[model samples]
Target: MKKIILSASLAFILFTNLKADAQIKLSDIFKKVTEKQSTTSTTGTPSSLEIGQGIKEALQLGVSAGADRLSAKDGFLGNLAVKILMPPEAQKVEKTLRSIGLNSLCDNVIVSLNRAAEDAAKEAKPIFISAIKQMTLADASNILLGNNDAATSYFKRVTTAQLLQKFSPIVTNSLSKVNASKYYSDLTTQYNRLPLVKPVSTDLTGYVTQKAIDGLFIEVAKEELKIRGNINSRSTTLLQKVFGYADKKKG
Candidate 1:
């Protein structure tokens, strides 16, 4: 009977220890889950206002930087990626002119074209700011979660028509100011005078306007991608918070 009682007490102690161990293990798991939830809740979601401001700030920064860079002297001329080349229809004109040793004229036209584009780029900042101001909360939210070029795509969709309208007059004025129009006319006249060669007529103002807008958009896209992917490019606390959430979502 003593042996039986002893066994029962030992079994009770063993059962108590097992239950305590299980409870401790379960508590550890629960603690970990709670900690994860707390961390996520605190850091994973940005407020709607923050979302809007963050997106706008990012776009503004990108467009402003792009506009500034392109507006500077040699911005377009120096950048092969954004350089405005002669229109496809005028390529023959340039080649023929260069081949015939009218290299200076060709160079003048090229330089003047880039100069016109650079002059027109100065107008992009206000226009971009206007478009950025028009962005809705929903738009900002979608852009925040969208692809790297999402903001640039948004800008293109909303601002292309306005940019074209705004840049046309500016480019036209700049073309005259910079002598691009005259050089182009001279180039075409020289090319057309060559025997057995077809005449080439191009809308110089229209071409420069479109190319300038394209170059600005390209620069903006690069800036957007940089900000989205490079944490070092986040130049503000708001950017860090907004993009930090985006980073976790991607992961």
Candidate 2:
């Protein structure tokens, strides 16, 4: 009887301890879940909408800045990096002209080319914004985590055709407005008449239009790099959050 009673008491003790232990474990789980919920509410990951919009906004700002800077007077002419120069085929023409004391003519052609580029750059902002608005969510996500110039590369890819079509007419008009077409024709005519020179028939409008587009992309790439690498370049909360997550992912 004593043994039986002792066994019952021990079982009761064990049951009580088991109940206490289960309660403690359950409490711990609840606390952990609550803490996790709090952390998530305070600092959650950015959603697809935020990521997509953030990338689009950044591109918009970058492209606008690029267009504005390049459209300014002396914008292309003053910047050695993006300065329009004589096409490769016409380098010899330029040299010959310069050697014959036609330096003024050569200078005029170069200045006019850059001037046309600057004039056409004024139309870039709206086209770029339109292209950016059409970007897919997948593209935005890829650009957010891709290389520093990924956004620039995507922009170039998607907008090049439209830009070419859009810039050609403007560049042609700008060339005329700036007297580039006349100067180029006069210069080429002079070069073509040189003894034993192959007839040069370069398309000045096409060359200038292509070069102007290239220069704009260079400026856009610079801005994209700045936004990706420098935290301060993220001008909005969404940009901060989206790129901040990218920073961590990269690290």
In the order shown, the candidates' Cα RMSDs to the true structure are: 11.7, 11.9
Tally clashing residue pairs in candidate 2.
0
Tens-place lDDT per residue, model 1, 153-214, is 99999999999999999999999998899999999999999999989999998999999999
Model 1: per-residue Cα lDDT at residue 147: 85
Cα error, residue 36 of model 1, in Å, equals 18
- Residue pairs clashing in model 2 are none
User: Which residue pairs overlap in candidate 1's backbone?
Assistant: none
Q: Which ten residues in a row have the lowest lDDT in candidate 1?
A: 36-45
lDDT of all predictions: 0.92, 0.91
Expressed as tens digits, the lDDT of each residue in 1-251 for candidate 2 is: 99999999999999999999999999999999998876554244789988998899999999999999999999999989899999889999999999999999999999999999998999999989988989999999999999888998898888899999999999999999989989988999999999999878789999999999999999999999999989899877678888888888899
Backbone clashes in each candidate structure, one number apiece? 0, 0
Quote each prediction's TM-score.
Answer: 0.82, 0.81
Question: Superposing every Cα of model 1 onto the true structure, what RMSD results?
Answer: 11.7
lDDT of 1 at 136: 99
